[model samples]
Target: MAIEHADVLRAAHLARLGIDDADATRYVGDLSRILEMVDALQGVDTEGVAPLAHPLDATQPLRADEAIEPDRREAFQACAPSVSQGYYLVPRVVE
Candidate 1:
């Protein structure tokens, strides 16, 4: 899990990051320590631990789905920069 300068440089190239020689050495050591910590965590027993999506047990009430008539279209269209036939007109992109 000890990351070398070569490994750091290779990782930088893969991630499209431009890392200089001085920073490469420092970054390699940091990355090595992180990898070591992860490797150490492999020794821990996490059996019988239930995976949770949310930290707290909470649920939102589902509302009934039904289509309903909305307010005035003319009023809504009035806010648009440009509107025609209840639709906003956007600038043309392709010729």
Candidate 2:
């Protein structure tokens, strides 16, 4: 799980990062420690632990999917500059 200088450079290149020699060396050490921590965590025993969708178990409230307003397409279209058969007309832009 040791991160090398080449690994750091490759990762930086893949991520589109512009890192100098000093920063790349620092990243190598940082990334190696992170991998070591992950490898250590993989050794933990959790056979009896149950997976949870959320930390808290509570139902989320939801509103009814019904409309609360009347349609006003005619009233709105009456104010438009140009409308025909309930459709707005715009000038042709493409040749």
Q: Each candidate's TM vs. the true structure? A: 0.46, 0.46
Prediction 1 global C-alpha lDDT: 0.87
Across residues 27-64, which tens digit of lDDT does each residue of candidate 1 receive? 98899889998999779787997777788799777978
Which pairs clash (backbone N, Cα, C closer than 3 Å) in model 2?
A: none
- Model 2, range 1-95, lDDT digits (tens) per residue? 88899999998999999999999999999999989989997787879988767887887799999899898999899889999888899997798
Q: Can you give the lDDT of residue 17 in candidate 1?
A: 98
**Model 2 scores what on Cα lDDT?**
0.90
Query: Deviation in angstroms for 14 in model 2?
Result: 0.3
